[model samples]
Target: MGKVTGFMEYARLEEGYEPVPKRLKNWKEFVIGLSAEDSQKQAARCMDCGTPFCNNGCPVNNIIPDFNDLVYRQDWQQAIAVLHSTNNFPEFTGRVCPAPCEAACTLNVNDDAVGIKSIEHAIIDRAWLEGWVQPQPAAVKTGKKVAVVGSGPAGLAAAQQLARVGHAVTVFEKNSRIGGLLRYGIPDFKMEKSHIDRRIDQMKAEGVEFRINTLVGDLPKDGPAAKVTNDATTTITPAQLQAEFDAVLLTGGAESPRDLPVPGRELEGVHFAMEFLPQQNKVVAGDKLKDQLRAEGKHVVVIGGGDTGSDCVGTSNRHGAASVTQFELMPQPPEVENRPMTWPYWPVKLRTSSSHEEGCERQFAIATKSFNAGTGKDKGRIKSLTTVKLEWKGGKFTEVPGSEQEWKADLVLLAMGFVAPIASVLDAFGVDKDARGNAKASTDLSGGYATNVPKVFAAGDMRRGQSLVVWAIREGRQAARAVDEFLMGASDLPR
Candidate 1:
């Protein structure tokens, strides 16, 4: 509401990116954030609608209008304060969130939505540059210990909240590093590791302890689950955590990738996206990986049309793949959404990520039938795959007759998305699981996030199945409040 006619006077300004050819050579963030002036103009586009749907549209229910107004008025400090009041890491969400808030913007019904994500990016980046982000240590110690398993957005959010409320918090990560999916799942080209590092430093200064390479529970010894990244040198059982900590929060994300049970799936060149992605991230972090999976000089086929699949395409291009092709089981969505019908809600529309723009041949309404192995010297490695076109009829996919085809491919990356959290970990804690295999937990205001087991709570993908990072952070913050109430009989922390 800073300027009533601002929306009519200003057009949305998008963030910029580096040239594709030049950015392909390095694994670093390429997005050129909106400048102060551009951000102000974009923020000025926020209409003074009677109701701001963007607040509820955001996973954390951020005060969107206030931040937009602050940014429009050039109040950088206040803008970040409003941003951090709801989000623990605007840097992460600002960089990677799909920006459902923008989709729900009042202006979006008839015009381009305000550039909320870009404004957030500018505010946080500026705040960091101005030394506005600092440690907020508690003045009094609660003397209660809390254990947070997994260092992803959810776990980090919960740990920071609990630590700020004067509780002793220790975060356990199975990987060698602190960030869970942020460090391994996301490519550096989208968001660099330095953001996670600085947050870890701030959390450390705020009296939170991080135990990297520590597994809270056992993982399956073999199978697809076993292939998940784990560099744990120490394993602590659920019983030990229950005895040692006042509360235990499970934020370990959904790590079980949905497998494609097709012929020749055992081919050496076929791998899960996680298997290939984490290795590249580790390499980028200066870790030497033995027999690293590379797409260089190979015909790469990435199965799945989600963000993970797009990421695969980008990484493959960075690896100098001869070609990259992405497949989608469903038909392609419309390029533009019908705002009249889907206003104030996330609409189904075609989304082409920066990775897709780099270079990728996308196939929709297709299904893979089998992987084929190579001959002689290339035996045991994937060579090609058979696919079939599908038609959507009567609410299900039916393969089209006489549409079978084989595509040449030297490597196949399965990026169909995660199914659920590692079952072994949930079982170890004696936590009940939903039909979908996610930890069974309710979000009820009374005893929300509480698992069946005593003193154990579950949040994020572990409880809700695979979802956006912003949702994970929301669950983490809410779970922290739930745990706080359980410990002190009440809580002042925001839900």
Candidate 2:
């Protein structure tokens, strides 16, 4: 617990941000992090609430109040120790996580919640600055080998945990680089890739092997019908991997996007969110992209009101789009949640992203009817979007009469979210899948992350479907413990 009256004495302090006008010019993180003193004061706001809902609210069950108390006591190293005990990468979560912990804070009933996220950000950064963060090499080698297929947060967490417990861990990534979505899907402006690079270095120092450009699946005999990014000349077959590794953990993420199957879906201008996001991230990493997906001087319409949609808006703004508009099929939510009605659970409320602040017209209660492809020579390209006004009636969406309208647009980005993990990958491994197409695995203490297939396991988005990075890390850690127990008939690893 923190100071007895700290909650009453200290008001929540928020971290500052770079001006929109200045930040829009470059693809760099513009967050003005809180000063050391202010961050400590924010940490002091943590109260002696009998039940810490912040722990339950956090996906990884981070010891928020403990770290907050540590920080308030100016024990930066101890604060980070408390943080790292639960979260493998507090830096990533602190930067991007929506901080449901704050929502579940007791102080949030009438006052601002403890600035847990910012305190986390401050602790990890201080730990790094003070060189407290280092590779923890295993004391003894178990001679067990594990292959974690994915370099996202989940896979990374699992690999690190296994390696620290004396298992030889090798991470397989299909992309040319590691850090799956962190290296590709997320823009550098939101979080610098150096965070990932340094972590990779630390993992390497801890004796974990990283294999990039190694796709774990059958090769398309005739090559892809359309160009997709990956460097695997012949995809590493799952059979080969299973035979090579003692235990195989599939954490490849949900890559299959949910497509809008309306007319003109194949138009050249309409692209999935992943296709647009990774390209910019690559460009930011100094890769020369051929015919980059630029929103330059084009009327941009983004479908989906989620984080991916917001990302599209920010990228489009940087691309200098003529105008950016977002469409959401659902009705607009209230500005603030009624905390009394939904205390511990995450509530439905309007969320405006940093991208939204840059510039964008957001339309709720609207549905895309169809794409309007131009005539003649431009028949394969999108020219506009025809949308229909929608209304909620009897808890269902209904189209408004005579509300159909067309808006001219040169580009349309679909951020409609992912449906499931790629079926081909799961099929290759002969792993059973859930109804949602995610890898089916029981999370029981005995079987843990075991799949129907012997010696095979699943975690992260591949097992849980689309989810947060923090959840992925938690699943990865839990799966690692399960795998260790399976191999050794017991495990000292944290659950």
Candidate 3:
């Protein structure tokens, strides 16, 4: 978009990070963003292909090339404007998004893709520093009320959009603070909570009401909510929400974690990723708890190779773990992908995260047969994991005979992905569910995001199952448009 041959002339410049030894000392972001000149050079790499597949690759449909061109020309003000036109929280995605757009970059066909994410990070940070990011409360009030259940990315996005469009939007969160998983499930090291707090402030300025420590739907007087971060003893019924608000939108994300049904699963010292991650996030925020979980001097075994598992590994290292090991059931993919076959698409290949760089052992194609309970000196806790090698054939895994092994583990965290939204909430609202247990609502343009129930709608993980923040944002924005259309004859809001 800048120099015709910028891609050929300039090499990719990735963000820098603090050394592992230094970064592990605290729960803070360590990635140093690209400099202005470096960001401009990287933006110049954008070929601005006639058909930009990166636009489609991004779930939010960000106008990537336009911003890249703007940044390349050092039009930083217009760059931020263009970025905000599509993305409500580039700051969130810039830090946490896996950058699928880069994978679909036209130049990625046979060369290093344009550093789209780094440029996005640069644009948003500069916008904040220059005081360009500000609230735009509607000039006129619509007198319409929308009740948003959940304070996760999807709920927050929908609430912000609706509030900006003059709807009285109230966001319900059960946690003590807002930002849902962003404030709890994620470690502060990957992305500090300040980003979410600032956005919350902006949203509040835009007239969005945030009811923290208030549950929208029912929660058992005592349930898994305690294990997570539930501070409110009060609950709001679905009927109350539907009756009070002109429209109701469900964005309460998938929270039903996939469990490992094996022997000794109930043993002490075994936990879910959400259970482990939130506690540390709270600790970093200056919260204290009795018998807080720590990995210090313990052999930690994290049972999943996804981002959540990687977070566990990094947190353990910070806790001064004696050793750490991660397990993945699927066989490892090649270190590099076949560009010709997988061009313009997310490729299947080995991905080593920054956390893996700290220090940890990784095992692939391994199945956990059971958890071995420790006794005697170790005392009624998880002592080891019994596993077996697997042979992948015909889309299923078959255990290899006589390939059993068990390793000592003082603590184990299950990092398997979530299955669906909390069942009670959906049931309370009487919303239909997909086979996967997510709320059932078609994405068809004619009646997109609407539930079978009149005046009620659903979006994000609650409807689509577990997904990235970008996808949640897209759903939230689209659902807002749908809700706006339903409230009026039609909507001027972007779809």
Best by TM-score: 1
Q: Put down candidate 1 lDDT per residue, 1-495, tens digits, no spaces.
A: 898899999999999999999999999999999999999999989988979999989999999999999998999999999999999999999999999999999999999999999999999999999999999999999999999999999999999999999999999999999999999999999999999999999999999999999998899988888899999999999999999999999999899999999999999899999999999999999998999999999999999999999999999999999999999999999999999999899999999999999999999999999999989998998999999999999989999999999999999999999999999999999999999999999999999999999999999999999999999999999999999999999999998
Return the lDDT, model 1, position 109.
Answer: 94
The TM-score obtained by model 2 is: 0.97
Clashing pairs in 1: none
Q: Which stretches of candidate 2 lie over 4 Å from their true place?
A: 219-228
lDDT of 3 at 467: 90
> Candidate 1, TM-score vs. the true structure?
0.99
Best by lDDT: 1
lDDT of 3 by residue, 1-495 (tens): 677788888999999999999999989999999999999999988885799999999999999999999998999999999988888999999999999999999999988899999999999999999999999999999999999988999999889999998999999999888988888877899999999999999999999998978887665444443355677767888889889999999998788888898998888989888888888998899987778899999999999999989999999999999999999999999999998999788999999999999999999999898888877976769999899999978978999999999998989999988888887788888999999999999988878999978889999999999899889999999999999888876888888
Q: How high is the CA lDDT of each candidate model?
A: 0.96, 0.89, 0.90
TM-score of each: 0.99, 0.97, 0.98
Give the CA lDDT, 0 to 100, for residue 259 in model 1: 96
**Residue 298 shift from truth in candidate 1, angstroms:** 0.4
Ten residues in a row with the worst lDDT in model 2? 219-228
